[model samples]
Target: MNKAWEGDQHNLKPLVQLLHFGYHQAMSCIFPVAIFGTLALSSVIQIPFLYRYDAILLILLAVQYLMYRSGLETRDEIKVICIFHVIGLVLEMYKVWMGSWSYPEPGYTKLFGVPLYSGFMYASVASFMCQIWRRLRMDMTGWPGFVSSVLLGGAIYINFFTHHFIPDFRWWLTALVFIVFRKTWIIYRVRITTYRMPLTLAFIIVGFFIWTAENIATFFNGWKYPDQHDSWQLVSFSKISSWFLLVIISVIIVAQLKYVKANRR
Candidate 1:
């Protein structure tokens, strides 16, 4: 029996490799899955003693700590996530003030109508990109230089706020992204094979999925547009463009750490 088991071990190699590949991809989703699961749970359960918003914030913080202690998240990744949290919080404060959206529920953890936990959503997005990049050993070819990318990202971030007051330059910014990243290729590995995609296309695809998730979140009372105060509606398709631009900002932030690591190596 032992001899037979040893003989069959070679036959199991492919299956083992496949499982290993899947595990890495699944690990990349841990942060996002935690966020979405909490969102789902919060929607249905209302505790008598605790606000759902504050509870979820605690839950997410616990999850984040566990990820770090378990080594599921690296220190550099946490640094990036923290920056993303602050960025998201700043945007939330401004957007709420602008009446772009509102959190209808009351919670002690909220300031200026934005729950502290809301920042985790943006951090989760950054976590996803960071984890996937590390797991797949991704690399970008034909990337615009750091200075150019940073300036472009700053413009996109600024435009998000300024558009409400001034003429929207989003279309021009979208064009700029194309011109900068048109030749860029995202190289990633799945199992033993490496595959590549256009960076621009990836932005659009990820943006579409985020827009879908936004609709689900709004339906579950995560936040509401002014129109949705009466009744829920699908998030506008136009928001996908905004998300697409946001993804660019995230990628640039993650890439800073990645490039630094590469240079060190």
Candidate 2:
């Protein structure tokens, strides 16, 4: 009887830990959830005298303000989000011009056929990373030197643009990412226990989830691919590789910012 009780307790312990990990992950995703909720609600509901895209833009602005004022995100984190917003908007303008994907809705906030609120979608990814880093007490081991990390990140960002004109170097960049981060590990805490995950594995995991969210976003008309214009369907699994590279860029920027802040203190 005692042996059975001990076995049950052992099983329950890991289950509890898993639940805790999941709960924290959800909390870290608050910004993303809000953005997704806005996408969904705006799709179904009408705001008089306002376009859907414009309304979404207003709602996201309010949400950002509330998150800052309520202390849900720190000032530094807000800066990070804004930086990513610009980075994302620039990419959006280029991609839309290149006919990669598009905003099908009309909005006053449209610039070069891309909606302003669209940048928030990218910023939300950065928000998640920042929130999770703090909530999980994340750190890195075997981090690469500054120049190598920065050059890799720059290459990844540039490749997003250059791929249209030149040969797509994404596979090459992916290989470099693995080689550069081969020894890097993400150390994070779940409850009282610390866990380690390879940095590359973490990027792939987050990228897959981002790709999943992309499907949901497209279904709600957040944006549409050429294929999705006729009927909604799943985003290509190949895009996961694109997002995998993007996740690396996001992490590198955030990690460097965190390192800078840590050293300043």
Candidate 3:
């Protein structure tokens, strides 16, 4: 043992070590107790009925905003995230209106388990992402936030059978989107450093893991499409191709969004 290392380790006291379990219980409570409370209430009332999922999401977002409020959280951060909420809300609402998928109605709008609020679900996600970026020292500074989201968003959009997000295949063209979008993003948002190559590769690999998780959820939930009208069950080459198709689809969505955003601006 080096003298300096030994001295530093010895300097730690028993009381100081007790801080290790600080916030785990608090966060764990969020999933079961808090979320469950809101969801149950949301689902039970009809005159003010709303999807439990939507209500729980709104609660979480409000909570997240409170958590991430810096002594001086900037207006710009708030603006960017609000835009995310608006865009997501519009996209989902449009899908609903188009009969892409219907949610519990002939013509009912549900928000926060009541009515007239569609954006809160996404506002909550944006706030959580904001908090994560702050902690990771990640740069969500520019188009990276917007561009990265399309791929991630599409993957989330596809697995309606699980989690807060409901999946839709209407925009399957996004499969070829992210690869080219990665190049575009690399050019515009990312400032090149020596570690750029590895960091970019890391992002791609992480995306693959996310895709794998999505595949399992969607596949098990009977949330998949048949190839030539034949269901191959799961765990076959067809399923593997479906995952590959997601990568391609993500790339496409990224590119399409990049184009639209660029041309619009």
Candidate 4:
């Protein structure tokens, strides 16, 4: 009894809180720099130039932080992360096939025996360490979150339209299929969970602005394909709005994560 009480008393101190916080900050900073830095050093980094993708990834981490402010609990983050990325992989592959973009996936690696050209990005995506996302309450019944993520992905398509860089419809269609099926995810057996306002809005606004600005700059700088029409106007509402919707979806993801983590503890 005395030992247990003593341990509780020790954990309740203000200094313990500060020490815990300091430890977390140190860990977060070291992680991104190390992960991205290591990838940068790899000889087989056959993907597009690193700057833009890293910038976007960094912005996403920042957005997650701003929304949670504290952090997330370990939940079902992997399924969510994989679903989104697989959607992206499909889109990217279709883009490559149509000559919408180009990269190296040299001869002999079979996609049903074809020399697929999208190995770099599809492979590079696995490096994100997104297992953290799986720690959330997934909604399998409702159309809201699923519908929203699909729209967010679609909005991604629209963002490039100003430049006339339309991806093949197959990309959009695969995302739609995934969105519809998110309703049947295993987590749906439980209640649909989410976080409250202000924080939700914070994640949306901060994440969106940071991601949009950086990606826009990256697009113009050649790390990504911009609108085929060469329409690079900052005032364009279509480009701006697409990111806004994406932000909405991002907030939903964070909210579900928050609920799952809090409950697990």
Candidate 5:
């Protein structure tokens, strides 16, 4: 038991703590939730003149500005999210061209057959990570050195594109990820007690939730897998591995940024 709960009187401390954890988790998800809501609402509602994709892009821009003005996200965090937006958009364009998945809707805010708002799906993941890192006061221990981590991240990203032409090296890279991060741990606080989890486990957990969200996103017609073109179906469970790897890249970028920011202080 955590020392923070030692003073429990009614034996409800465990339940209370669980609720508190859930509350903070929800708070950390504001951006993704907003994106999901927009996807769901736009699916059924017909805008007078604007295309659904363009409307979603406009709404998300407003949401981003409001989040900044309301102090829900800091300027640095927003910059990180924007960096992820570009990274995700580029991947999206390439993947779509390769016929991995597609945006079936017509929109003025499209480039290379991809809707501009599609990038926000990736940005929302970074938004969740940044929000949770701050909310829980997260810290890392046993992280790999900067150069090594960057090289691994770069390899993981390039493999995503090159794997189409060459033999897939994802499994080999996954092995390297575990080797590199074997000793890493992430410490976070809930109430007055601190807890630590293996960094790789944390990546798996976030990856699973993102996979769940991917199913919902597909249900709402956010994008379509080739198999889902005729009718909606659950995203392949195998994609969890992909999300797991992508989560690693996201964490590495955010972690490096946080490291640099802290050192400058």
Candidate 6:
């Protein structure tokens, strides 16, 4: 440890430690924070001619660029974000088609009733996971066989769509996840101290937070679930299960990248 931080760790007050941890946690969420801030602003403001959604799209793109150019995001992370963007866009297109959700605002940047910037919402989730993983030096142990895990993730993704037409196997998938990741542990650091939690628990915790953000997003009219079409309401807690599965998908992608990069070194 550095001389300054050496005794500092032992003597630090709990409130100070909490504040420090909070700052670091906030740093890991910069992308999500930026996008959410923009959403809050756009909800209340209007431009003369340009659509608010279009302007927000441009702002999000610029933010992505600046994050990269400023060395806050890496080339590999950008690739992951782009992948997430496309995945999100595709899902949004389908969900809007199915009346699962709808974007009510007018925008020139919309495709098939989905605004281009809408994808950034999902990308923001990826950005959060990627940044947090790196910032905390997160690692996993007792991971299930990668091939099986990836296959399970794919099934979970597929079920998201297929459930509308056929039987919903999400609960079963959740069970499988519990089994596969039963022994897996996510290890991360806070300052010089290390902590660990079950990977499945981490997924559930992230899912709950994302569910909270969803409520905020809906309140700002980012998009609306069917229940919100009449009036804004708290998003259903049931949706947390869906977000949990989605987090699994995101984690699988990030973990694969980390694993491959590690092997190359």
**Model 6 lDDT, full chain set:** 0.90
Candidate 3, residues 1-265, lDDT tens digits: the string is 6998878776863333334222332332332233334434554553345444444456656654654474223454466456655655665566555444334422244642222333543343343333333323343112444456555556544542232354444234334334433543222111221112232343455345435543443333212333312443434433344334333333334334435555788
Q: List the candidates' TM-scores in order.
A: 0.90, 0.96, 0.41, 0.36, 0.96, 0.93
Q: How would you order the candidates by TM-score, starting with the best?
A: 2, 5, 6, 1, 3, 4
Q: What residue runs in model 2 are displaced by over 4 Å at the alpha carbon?
A: 1-9
Regions of model 6 farther than 4 Å from truth: 1-17
Q: Kindly list the per-residue Cα lDDT of model 6 for residues 204-246, writing each as its tens digit.
A: 9999999998888889888988888888888988999999999
| Every candidate's lDDT | 0.91, 0.96, 0.41, 0.40, 0.94, 0.90
Report how far residue 75 has shifted in candidate 5, in Å: 0.4
Kindly list the per-residue Cα lDDT of model 2 for residues 1-265, writing each as its tens digit: 9999999998898999999999989988988999999999999999999999999999999999999999999999999999999999999999999999999889999999999999998999999999999999999999997999999999999999999999999999999999999999999998899999999999999999999999999999999999999999999999999999999999999999999999999
Task: Using lDDT, rank the candidates from best to worst.
Answer: 2, 5, 1, 6, 3, 4
lDDT of 4 by residue, 1-265 (tens): 9999999887775565556544544443333334334334432343464433344345444543443444441224434444545544565556555555433323233242222222222222221222212322223334355456556545555544423455434345335534543443333111233422232333335445535443443334322343433543343443344444444444445445545666899
Please, what are the lDDT tens digits per residue for candidate 5 over residues 7-89?
Answer: 56447867877888899899989999999999999999978899999999999999999999999999999999999999999
Q: Count the backbone clashes (under 3 Å) in each candidate.
A: 0, 0, 16, 14, 0, 0
Question: Model 4: what TM-score?
Answer: 0.36
Give the higher-lDDT candidate: 2 or 6: 2
Return the lDDT, model 2, position 20. 90
For model 2, name the residue pairs that clash: none
**lDDT (C-alpha) at residue 163 in model 6:** 93
Candidate 5 is scored at a TM of 0.96
